[model samples]
Target: MKKAGVTPHIVHVSTAYVAGARKGVVPERSLDHDARWRTELAAARAARESVEWDSRRPAVLRRLLAEARKDHGKSGPQSTSAAAEERRKEWVENQLIEYGRLRAQSVGWPDVYTFTKALGERVAEETLIGVMPLSVVRPAIVESSLKHPYPGWIDGFKMADPLILAYGRGILPEFPGLPDGALDIIPVDIVVNATLAVAAAPPPVDEPAYYHVGSGARNPLTFRGIHESVREYFTEHPMPDGGRGQIKVPEWTFPGARRVERQLRTGEKVLSVAQKLLLSAPATKRTRHWQDDLTRQQDKVDFLRKYADLYGVYTEAEVVYTDNKLLALHRSLPADRVEDHGFDAAVVDWHHYLQEVHYPAVTATMRKATVGRRTSNSALPPLKRSANGGDVVAVFDLEGTIVASNVIETYLLARLCDLPRSGWPGELADLVRKLPRYLAAERRDRGEFLRTFMRRYAGADEAGLARIVHDRLGDALLRRSHPEAIRQVRKHRAAGHRTVLITGTVDVLVQPIAGLFDEVVASRLHVRDGRYSGFLESPPLVGEARAAWLRRYAENAGALLTESYAYGDSYSDRPLLEAVGHPIAVNPDPHLYRHARSRRWPVAQWKAYTLPVGDAFLETVP
Candidate 1:
């Protein structure tokens, strides 16, 4: 395009971190720097250990222990043992930090936002330079703009807004990081102006031109300054109805192991008491309060886990040092262009921008995006009853209704009995045949049933079991799902009729299929150490349990239970079908057909798949 006489101004917006080389500072960029990444790695390692920790069996555990002992012995004792240990610990900590930083760099900045920008810079350097007019503008912490087209024009919450919201709501109790640490905040207008200036200026031919636009270097504002400003602003404005009126300025606190231990212990004790009260008490105001308190405490715990180690630590101090370079480039441009596009930061007032404008803009924008739209048709078709006063609640059975297979028992047998595809069909036949007996015995003695089952066949590793489920069982189940059945359910939901898929399948299998239904009533299985304990710790779906779940779903949906529709192909779903007003049999088995016919319920059969409302529903809803 450029060779064809098109002058393309490729505006590459990159992070100021890439310009860190000029300031001699390392930027922590990458997904590896993410707190969740570390947490997940630790969890995976812990899980591996937990699954094979017992050494009495000796095969896997002995190999792991021997490897650990070998590694532990590599570091021999030294002179000044305590000092050496301390030094070693520090070295390990530094290595981990560097590892995280490198990981982040590999992924780009600490998150996707900066990494994409860095990629854009590289693209401009490699392809755009000399080919087309190109200028790379680096913005450090591009925050909410104070004055763009107007005052308080913010795109979205970038960096400081989340922390500010947390602080204002008293959700953040302690301040993390060094009080004196540099907080490089740049208003959006300044960033925009720099972008415009770089774009309008003549490109430096034969070389790539760069501009570092930020605040900390030209006009430094410390973390302390930010905290103070936030406190002052919130105090004056007094968050809606004096809701964070008593805003307190945070003091820098250093990381101490003993202090952390004490805090955790205190928090645990309070949380434990709150949890007990919430579990034991019936639904009431006090119970609700306790639950909220427990949730808030957990949030605090999560927050601490992310920031505790780095709290009050002045980690980085580099500022934008490309000012002279940018200024020189600006001067080289023609006078008219320079006058028209000036990348000046001193003209902007950060405090006024953040407090007076940015906050309000963010709140308004979020409100518009999040608040649900109101429809013109207030008189919606009754979800519980059709126009002819027929039942509308459409309940689907798990195994044969929507899904093609009995996922729960199939998954359990595969995991516990090591039943592969070649052998599972026979095993399934046997299990189904013996299910009545096992269920009867389960009611009498669960421990006996589990022991008998495990003793009979429990030898497969976690990987092998997961492979069998995902590759074999899952594939078969997904393939077997009657396309017409799914289409009908989707149709009912689109027609303003409440649709629910009730199953005796475990959460792992059922949750994946949740996208197919409006509400899922799946069995919850207790999993420990990456494997099922081969027991249903909770009551299975039957009788009152099934009816209660349906009734609650109906109540919450504001639909009449007696005027709702239900569809099933099994005798086991009799209670559920009876609970609803309308019962329909879809591809019903002999027993279900007989039962439905006796009850005078409607029977619908479909040869082709078609969503009830069709193209019109998709166009109107989504």
Candidate 2:
């Protein structure tokens, strides 16, 4: 309205959650919690310069770090300086997010989303008071339509849908929420009707009208009621279990936050110990399968913990909205109009809505959503390898060791999809910020960074990705290929050794260069209906996983481990290098250089655009 410079009546669509963290009867009025939010907003704005604009927040931070490093001198040993810079940047970004979260939670709102909404109301109230007639309608959680054009009209998963979906799937065994607390839900149609009614009759000139369009005051439905109705609905219309018969309706145990936190900590420790034990043991197919399962379970635990941490407060709070203005407006409306609009919340039957309409609609939507998605290793067919009866093998890490640059990262940050080149600066800043995460992956779980990074290709088609590699990344990668590395692989081929190009990059991208090696052991991305499922068919073959695969291949093909040769260019490749008798770090990063020196290993720098190593060097083994 301010930007438009208009005196037209405005009906501002806002959340009833402007009540903030205050309990008891929440009157339909403006938010009064400004003391905390003001300080928070100021602090947030002050640190805004630290953040670079990009699609993903994490990626943006990474790019900023990279930029900082580039701005600083890059010569001699930069490991210490680079590490410090990365840590500082990571710490700043983390602190900014943490501070914002804390500031939001401190003022009774569960998250910044709701808290910011309340602040927006303040801005409108202050700025648009004299210019236009304003009526702010604060509606509670808007769910699917109860009765309107359709019985259970829904577009996508809304606020509480994920929790409800999890419950239906028998995954959410427990939730940290108050069963007795009013959920304060309102239908979408009612909110629209209420907005229209308020817009038709705005408050007196210079006086803003506030209405809470929710069911909590007159016809409250508690979380316990919602849960029971959903459970009954699912029990009657049990989802097919494929092979496990009927999936039992998950019995939720509403534990306190403290209890849940304790359980989470304990469970994490147990999972960690088990994972370590599994890692220490032999990397057979059975053991690897178990490890993968544990990783999935760990992912679930992490998600649950985060969900509880963010939303648990909402369940605990018992703030019932008093929609007196909303009721008055409904009463003032024409009898015919009221009948047509049906803006009244008191008439809504919670039992019928949850059991008959909402739950069924949500489940149906979920079914459709799950159709073309893969959640298992069966998604991608295995890559058939020609049987090679050999006693010698050569393992090469494809990215830095062979190609000189990370082709997969380049594909993601540059040419994966046809995006605007104007956004490259922001993206580069994001990559710089994420360098710490990459370093962390190298330091600990090597595949962690790849797993998180590859999620960008979630909905891309398999064939399309191949075309991308062949057309865009292929020529660039081949050009950047280390001549020395190519010669080394050929020498291994001459010796009758099975040359394997192993990488965490998708096998499809690396398939163009497949003819250069006897076997390609790169990570295979799972596909469903020819589209990427955003999951690996197997654990990414990097770090320890790479070493394990090498051992397995050696044993299966009768290759001598003591006679095998491996070449890599990263700290993440340390395990692979250590597995072979001849371990060489080619164009090694600072971390890998230090590690190789400590181990008395040979480190070679391969110039991408320079001449290849002489024939004499290739003829003899170093």
The whole-model lDDT of each prediction reads 0.55, 0.71
Winning candidate number (lDDT): 2
TM-scores, one per candidate: 0.47, 0.58
Distance from true position, residue 457, model 1, in Å? 34
* Candidate 2 local Cα displacement, residue 111, angstroms: 3.0
With candidate 2 superimposed using the best TM-score fit, by how many Å does residue 604's alpha carbon deviate from the native? 33
Candidate 1 lDDT by residue in tens digits, 128-225? 66776666677777777655567766666776676676565455555554456677777777677677767777565656566777766557677777
Report the error of model 1 at residue 304, Å: 6.1
Q: What does each candidate score in C-alpha RMSD?
A: 20.1, 19.5
